[model samples]
Target: MAPIINGRLLFNQLPNGLPVPGKTTVYDASETIDLETAPLNGGILVKILVLSADIYIISRMRDSSVEGRSSPFLLNQPIDNYGVGLVLRSEHSSFKQGDHIYGMLPFQQYIVMPPATAERFTVLSNDAGIPWSAYVGVCGMPGQTAHHGWREFSKAKVGETVFVTSGAGPVGATVIQMAKAEGLKVIASAGSDEKVAFIKSLGADVAFNYKTEDTREILAREGPIDVYWDGVGGEALEAAIDAASVGARFIECGMISVFTGEPYHVKISFNIVTKELKISGFIVTSLHQAHLSHFYETFPKLVKEGKIKYKEDVTQGLERAGHAIVDVITGRNKGKSVILVGEE
Candidate 1:
């Protein structure tokens, strides 16, 4: 059943000892959305079409107030992330009725969003000409992360050997593609042999199963990688550190391997003091301005030319969001996991 407009409130809770649960209520939105106070000028009402469930969301369950970074997933609020939606109502100057857009939206049935919210929501262009889910993957956060992190942080050179963990994931896949495009020799690692094959298909020079082959053994053969794109941290990070080249650059993106439970501690074989390597952790939110500009400036063109490809593991309905999120977090689903919120 479709949610009753302005009469429903969805809340997500991750209590101390309980598993995460999403609760829905037929409540008034007048209190939550401030409907009476919402600006009448150029606002949009969107029904989500597809939503992304990334592993980083787990960190939001940690200490809420840390380093002045407030998490979006509060104790009892509905979680929100990048989602593609269809415009149901438009009172805004920029958007017309029935426009398709992608942006940060709550995990619910409907969102009456303001025009400012639409600023981040791009009108899906035809040049890319792919599935709407691509907006949540390559043309979205993951792809942008790979481009920006490599260009700005790593400054990866042409001949550099770039190592990427979780290479079968949307972000890591793009990292491998971009690295290969830049003429960098790419080495990738994943959890399974199947993922290793997929990584190799994406042009990774060498792909390994971290579960069986041992990352250390693989790195020993391809020692001295110049840039380590640390997407799956913990023990993988430890291994990458040992294999890094002198003055290597490590861009810490996601730590999926250690996102849940107690963090893993792996003693490094190399002396950072002697190796002179640099490791920097980056949150996509911090580089918002740059990412937004890059999204508009580059993505459409790449898509038009068929230069960029995105893969999505789509689940059919909104009711399945929780399972999809779990699948994404646990790496059970290959590629990006999205909840298909609307029919074509």
Candidate 2:
């Protein structure tokens, strides 16, 4: 039972725009624990291996008074999200040492899940030889967001056009691949030329750098987009609406562009009446019971077989987690942003 360093990132303050590492988060790695003797008290002690940093995390770092999609990050506490870890010691009957699990984990080098709380975690079996990082990206929450959104909301038919914003991101990348597999023409957008190139490599028929180009102009030229897989909202949504075909489907996953209180004046317009478009947003957790079984069974196989290639933006160490959050929110991350806390 030797002493082990326990490093964690705590939410320090809410940001007006993109958050700064030291200012927005307090990196506290001064704590130490004895892995063998630390009291679990009928719980499980885990060594966190991979920590997910998604754009949705920014949505949670607001004032507690303002109700939001997820719970607000409590100031001076660890930011909780999806993570993969290995059980080092367990007093719980269902869990034991050597088991790898994934759940809504705190951003720390180690964690102790109380008996009741440990019930929420799912033990994983990675026989497919997929990277542990994929569990936080293609095989975890972001993957579920895409898997469920496509099956549940997207009503795109074969030969139709499917448009995706943030096409280089985890959810958007998955949707683009899914649409391509289903015999649809894909038009996708990303904030940078590099991302647009990456999206095009994923079989998108048309990929554009949205920062320099006009969404309305491109959609007007190449659209009548049958299914709009939306990650960037505000003006992007307005453009999608303008380019949508009759009875088009809008799978609203994220609103990264407007989350930081940015001013956006784009009206939704009158197309909702004339076109009969179906715009739907979902929290992936809500759709889990209906779809998780199938998603876990099939999606991992697709990822392992290279049918769904995941683009990962991995930042090493718990120390850099705050900057990782910035990368995701500011669209600097090339794909699914993640903080690699440790090796599997």
Candidate 3:
């Protein structure tokens, strides 16, 4: 098979002289990716294998400043985010040729980076006996988001009751199992019936179809949630606020529901004050430095022992990345949506 280049690059301005719709464009780079021509001054070159499409990218696409966080993707350049890749050539001794690793990579056929720049992602191997993609899913940033959201902030205790929004997504699925592991009764909500059933398979005590079932009614029936792990905000958040226990802890991770170019109408501030809920917003990047080691040490065991399971809707080839990104954000993806950039 011939090598194919299908990555997309984003720019700030369109050809018509207006600002780029959302800092995006698609171009072919097959001939432009010769390793001989790639910069080799003092860094490693990685060939991405599996790249993830995340909901947060949707937030970036809409040109909104999400909680004052700057766009990770820059204008007039390829975007960058988490990707699993192999070091094809390296100036650094530690990252020699053929080392499988995962971390943020520019959206191109290959990306050069100083080994010292980003934190090194632990290499995956058959010896570890888990799919490499798990590093970017249940055992990766999304996993840590669920873990820290429930454990550190929510302070969810054994036998307590917890509710998580976006129950079918990557982070949501992990949160359900992790909550169960800690002996918490978990209830989760998703937009589709299939998602509701999938979350139930993941051991959620109660799973509801938020699309058809009224979140307020469901919460009223489920009731007195000790913790509200919110990955989707808006009306669901309002319902969570209304049903929270007296001292409920509301963990705000990512708000996927309202990220599109629409005015936010759901208001839960009054409920927050009256119910005296403890709400905290968190970014996964903030904990990357502090908790990186913990994720590496624990993720493998969870996969090997079957304590955790992951689902992925894989879209082959890099050209599919654009649609895949939109799918994940719109909840069209059943689990984590990944673009397979290369073969195993």
Write down the lDDT of every candidate, Cα atoms only.
Answer: 0.74, 0.90, 0.75
Residue-level lDDT for 59 in candidate 1: 59
lDDT of 3 by residue, 261-286 (tens): 46467775677777789999988777
Q: Give residue 339's lDDT in candidate 2 (0 to 100).
A: 83
- Candidate 2 wrong stretches, greater than 4 Å: none
Number of colliding residue pairs in model 2 = 0
Find the candidate with the highest TM-score and give its number: 2
Whole-structure CA lDDT of model 2: 0.90
- Lowest summed lDDT across 10 adjacent residues in model 3 is found at 12-21
Model 2 RMSD in Å is: 1.2
Once superposed on the true structure, which residue ranges of model 3 sit more than 4 Å away at CA? 1-24, 62-67, 115-127
Error of 3 at 265 (Å): 3.1
Which 10-residue window in model 2 sums to the lowest lDDT? 257-266
